[model samples]
Target: MIKKPLFPYNPKYPSVADLKRRAKWRIPKFAFDYLQGGCNEELNLERNESDFDNIYLKPHYLKTGGEIDMSVELFGRTYSAPFGISPIGLQGLMWPNAPEILAKAAAKHDIPYTLSTVSTSSIERIAEVSDGKAWFQLYHPTEDRLRDDILNRLKSVSCPVLVVLIDVPSFGLRYREIKSGLSMPPKMNIENIFQAMICPEWGIKTLQHGIPSFATLKPYMEKGLDLSQLGQFMNKTFTGKVNMEKVKAIRDLWPGPLVLKGVASEEDMEGAISLGVDGVIISNHGGRQIDAGESSLISLIKLANNPKYTGKVKIMMDGGIRSGVDLGRAHAVGSEFNFMGRPFMYGVGALGDEGADHTINMFKAQLYQVMQQLTLEKVSDFPTRLIR
Candidate 1:
């Protein structure tokens, strides 16, 4: 018989913040820091969430309302909601089998889940779990053969959308990661081992799932490579910067919808349009890169309002969005869709396999509440409710 989850969605832990608090205690400090830390002073990280408060919505209490329709249509598909799971790397490090867990949840809920190229689960594994509904995020590889191989693997799985990440031209200077000695094969010092011992649940689950590695890239990696070699391999494998030639190459190769992620400027937006990209996710790499950059919300408002980009490409934003209210704020500001990474990880970290389902349910419930309050009847109506 299948076992049930230890804790269901409790009213006491309704918010993502609550899940985060529980996750911090349940996982090792090093792992938690990897999931939560930002680069440099983390100004951009803090600003992403704080800037959402500046947006105000005007409720239409006097207007007539019926049941709210939360479904959204994008790229010839209708998702149950307007939000999706953003790509996150090393997800299994945060919680054992997190990528698979989130993929299953997204498939069950009829929402999109973008799998990171560096995530622990392989493309084939996630494709099976998501029933071919998962999207793939490509980190431009240094070798043409490697890039072509990964894209072909995605195609064999019948992946719907391909999201190319462009922001990480270089790794962020995350101090927490530096201090914790976090690496591909996590540096298991005495302190890290002790921390794991204290978090017995995470430790046991990790053992069951096997030690998290770059599963997606394992086929190409040398067998039984040491930690130092693995680090060197990663550094040599991926070229973080994405130029026009690379974008054009990918556009020419991939037949499905192509989305350009990490777009925070008009130049990048214009480039994506020129390259004939399908969508653009206005993100600041969750403030993990470039501490002095503007928040994703700030970038979204500017891009969404400009007529030049309004109909040119499908606009989505992701960074520091904690709840459905924040989703409403994004929609009000002309964002066609939204995505979140840390929130779903917090859920899985807090409640094991069941966390993904709980987190998605929470988002739906909270979004419905916001719609009722705004006297809105459909997800598309949110833009008109803005108090601009």
Candidate 2:
């Protein structure tokens, strides 16, 4: 018999699609658009999920199964699950106290929860909430002083893994964000105000939490700046690109395991290995940075097939993963570990404080069910069940 998850799982929102539908109805349109939309017609975004359909897993029904251990050891820590919550900017905008809620849940579950450079909750706060198990992703800054300062802060909190973002040389042309006035210096037009008015619960929570600002970057920002000035400051602070020189500089300073995010090709994977990066998360900024790019799964398969780079560095992925079966598929294909952004955000948006716990629990239950049927005993054993 399968074990029941202790976390509350609402039957009405068993699937991520149900949570997304409820989230759309709960939050303001602008917030939901920012959380869901991708760049340049979202072709890459569509491909991310659709591509998973091509992969299949083989189940061994006759084989007797022992214990199923979903725990995975990454960068010296043993997590309760192989998957984690991918960092998202402005999490509080989706639901007030979103980062704190997720961080607390992640701590309780022994899963990694990454805190973004621009997330609403501060580094120290998430460090406290996650019991220092949270990973931090840095959005490369223009100035060496700012970069060094952020690194020093991460060191202070003893962040286990430092993930430096390599994508976003330029922001994507997201039609929904553009039309919704969610662009930098995000404008709250009459329409947005009306939408907020309709969502009284969200509005009340926002009122209690205050408007979502970059809590991590607050110390560096000037006080009493208006929205336009805030946008200008942000544009001037982050360089939006990470070059070899930047990587070298960071490698020299950060003492812990360093992972590169937004890597999508063999060449980049080789470069990350050369730079002594402990791991590379095969991502296209969640299909938000480039629409012409291939899905993250495609990138992972390419790297997995190349034995030249295997075992040299950890290869992980994060795109279009919405279900436990999807998680199984990605792991079987070549990804050592996985992460997801929208599903967790949708969870928080749908159920508020209870959302993060519910989503993590659901993923655990779903993955366990799949593994039990496959007669898979370990997360690393997922590759054996692959049809390839």
Candidate 3:
């Protein structure tokens, strides 16, 4: 008989890497690469996690340890922790109805779960699962009509926060994806067949459900690549319309806290501040869009320390965090909150609905261990315990 996971859940769960391995073994090569692979050569991708490993820690064992308060307050709302599930498009491709699983898991834990503009599930579906704590990530469709409709859809779901992804003003050129035949909802061709055949578990689940599609996009377009082509057409069809004015218009409509993701430049940061946004997530789209840009960690450190950024707005970071040490290093340097795109998705891919819960437990476990050694308590203490 299969064992039951701990009741009310337990933080001392499996490792995120374990989930990654399980996900890899469960999905086709195309799907696995979509979760794991990054841009050309993936040097930046490897560097993102390895950079965290390079940072050292100094323990203070003699200090009287206290309670670990993981709760955080950001943009006038309190969260259970400083980390959240970052958005990924078409999550159902990894697991059947993945967005719902992520949203439900995040809600059960009282954390934020961001919904991608391209998610397989609708915003309203997330609202039902996440109880309106869901955050919406906007990609800024090129057409005003389409964009407004999307925003209205998010509002209908009663989402509390809006995170606009600006890093992908245009999609990045990812060589690994190209080599892997990575497509949204994926293309089930002769090549993908061999890939599925290799992963019997993934293939069986996929066959049972008839393969994941861009369910949200299906109503707008026909089946298979035809629908995908329509989405691509819409993207190219409206690229020129997504500008500062477009962003401002969105700001005017959405009355909740607005944060901008993919912010990499001082001017962009300044622009977000000018727009009167609530916060900014310093990210390089998880090193997904650009090849030469600095990691969000370096960018966050610079932006947070800058006199201009002092209390002007909240500063957060993504793109390199893998463990509590990484999250601690980022907080020590300057970042306040963080988001992880692939890791959480990997959880869902690895174990279907249970993936997000397992991944969150694993990360919490890693963080707890880090705290045990550092003689620290509470996530807030991370900023003060910095060491070279």
Tens-digit per-residue lDDT, 230-306, candidate 3 = 55765664355245787799899888888988787899999999999889998887777766777777778779879
**Tens-digit lDDT string for candidate 2 (7-82):** 4598888999999999998999999999999998899999999999999999999999999999999998889999
Give TM-scores for every candidate, taking all chains together and pairing residue i with residue i.
0.97, 0.98, 0.90
lDDT of each: 0.92, 0.92, 0.76
**Of the candidates shown, which would achieve the greatest TM-score relative to the real structure?**
2
How many Å off is the CA of 223 in candidate 2? Answer: 0.9
Candidate 1 runs further than 4 Å off: 1-8, 183-185
State each candidate's clash count: 0, 0, 3
lDDT preference between candidates 2 and 3, better one: 2
Clashing pairs in 2: none
**lDDT of model 3 at position 140:** 78
Q: Which residue pairs in candidate 3 collide?
A: 69-378, 142-238, 347-355
